[model samples]
Target: MPAPPIDARSQNARVLGVELCGDDGALLRIMPLEPVGLLRAGRFFMLRRVDGTGPYIPRPFSVYRQYDDGSIEFLIKVMGPGTRSLAQSSTGTELVCVGPLGNGFPELEAGTPKVMVAGGIGSAPFYLLIQQALAGRHGASLAPEDLTLIYGGRKAGFLYDLEAFMDLGVRVLAATDDGSAGFHGNVLDCLHKQWEVGNLPQTVHLLTCGPEPMMEAVAHEAAAKNLECWVSLETYMGCGVGICNGCSLATRPDGPLGAWPVAKACVDGPVFSTSAIEF
Candidate 1:
């Protein structure tokens, strides 16, 4: 079994700030007591208020951003008590933070066009990924034209941090269910449209993170198209480490993780190739 990174340890982090974003989300920033070195885009942290104001079990959040000052940000949708507590946090508030956990997205391949499909809050991890790809931080830097983001939501407001992503100078398209945003459909539909119009190549690498059903649909599409695809599962985790058996998912018998009947989302991955796991 794989283990959490050696640098993974629980520590108290001080709240630096919280900014309301999107329709019902907050960009919560905190400074860990100890330095957490460079973090990969999709890696996450387990967080909870130190004052015991929220659930005893800390909630997991993807690392939205990591600044030079050693502070990290989590783009949290104010959906439940766990997130609400974090949103209500004030400067100087202390919270327990665990990790820099799990494997992030794989390195970018040169000459392969990449398309990212994000749903609502699932857009969290892509920010850094796009930034890194453009900056050549990931192996084989990509041009802005080589990267595309198809961000979707029920409405415009769910497409969190839209302008920020656009500022990166990559192709960013919006999709909304109610026709209130860019395209009058979901992300998958938007993606198909791009291909149909020749805005994107038929053969391209795909990466997605969002609601389970959305991810399932994208996975099915990838399988049918025989395209290489990866998914960042938004699984419910009791513990962001391997100690708890709560985040297990069924594995594909012929896939890379087939040796194991099941894989733990926490340590094994929050990111896995679509071929390695069943939807």
Candidate 2:
């Protein structure tokens, strides 16, 4: 039998996959869906905001899967009215999406030491990267212990799937603002103490996602230690596809004083190097 002729809009699909982030949080899948299996793994995605009561704004979510399922996925945390409406959406609803957007991390280099810092729900994007890294094939020869995930949550329950990361052969270090598990303090505090004790590992690069302040702290720490770092920014979006300026951000490290044209977080990047961002 012939396949469906293929929807042109499907090539830039939004309804890629839907899954639960937590109990109340819902994560939507996205993809530049095309002839099945064409989408590459690790590419990014941005999609239109579900039309809610008012205050129109497109939300940005990283495409966690682009593995040719003709769909990709995004992880979301239900924060307010907009996301609540989105969380209630039934699967198979027609959606407007964009990309495979923004540049992602350079695959973990062979034998290169690396750290993944996830704040709250920011761990979404690197879930796949962790899987790949654990396999020792991050586009270069690598190893599982060569990477680690240091994630911070408000408490023990907020730390999702601790065993999943551990089973992948990646040591998952954890911290809670409340000291419920692992360490008691900021994830950065844990990182600094590790660095002080010479446990951070050498030749390490950091890949991170989470709240802006958290990512900023991680970036600053990485920069101070002369470690290479890549940060995924989570800014509010009016249009996840870059059409709206709501998601725009100042590009240069120094804004107004030394900053310049702001780049749209949805387009220019949801991921960027520490040097490229003001935060």
Candidate 3:
């Protein structure tokens, strides 16, 4: 999904040294990815390669950070043309990024627990959110509340670190589409089993992101429990800002007129509350 390339005029709006509250990127020059904030697990950022001439298409990626030094990272699965280019980038190839955009999960009440459900790359955003929540950002604290993050991937290799999330005082539950990881079922099934066994604690907010199917499934569970849930959406967005209408989606039937759920993936959001979104 190519967004219109940045025009000559667009170049004038460029800012220097984005002043990252958290700066982290890898591949020195090739594939540099970092978090923009004390990223909330359900938070996201607009991503676009800085070196470009065409409509600079922007996409949303989840945050991957677990530290307190304001460093954010992402789990990038190289499966596309854009990313392939970034993966092949040389050292110090700084990318042009826009925003710690979109609405993120708000502070959970002190007594409220948190349950994170992630799918593949979707888990990336939550990684930071979980970190921040546990760190007590925005008057949000997990001190008295329990934290559980359910992570899913295609297989064992796609899976990364449950220990890290656990280290943040989060109880991690892992699953794979295949029976290749901790659970022999999907994340939904894992959540179901927890539900069946009454393992999910009350006063827990659920945050989820990843493949559309997994998110839809998670949505079902959140609805079942009348729980507050947040979601990050991935779309082929062009124009990191809303100027171009590249990555857009159809709003739900209950949406406002002309309410294209397709907000600028760059400007509007890479992250949205499950209820506020049409998805």
Give per-model TM-scores.
Answer: 0.98, 0.79, 0.74
Candidate 2, 83-183: lDDT as tens digits: 65555666555444544555556666765577889987787777778766665445765666677788888887676555555666777888999898898
Give all candidates' CA lDDT scores.
0.93, 0.65, 0.58
Taking every candidate in turn, the Cα RMSD to the unseen true structure, in Å, is: 0.8, 6.1, 6.6
State the lDDT at 205 in candidate 1.
Answer: 95
Candidate 2 local accuracy as lDDT? 0.65
2 or 3, greater by TM-score: 2
Put down candidate 3 lDDT per residue, 1-279, tens digits, no spaces: 323223211211121222111112221111224423344454444555677732365455555653344444555655565654444454454566555544555666666677778876566666666666666774566652477788888776666555555676667888877787788888888887876788876546777777888887777777777888766667666654556667565555453324444445444455555665565
lDDT of 3: 0.58
Please give the lDDT score for candidate 1: 0.93
What's the ranking of the predictions by TM-score, best on top? 1, 2, 3
The TM-score of candidate 2 is: 0.79
Model 2 bad stretches (over 4 Å)? 1-19, 27-43, 48-57, 66-68, 135-138, 253-260
| Candidates by lDDT, descending order | 1, 2, 3
Q: Pick the candidate with the highest TM-score.
A: 1
Query: What residue runs in model 1 are displaced by over 4 Å at the alpha carbon?
Result: none
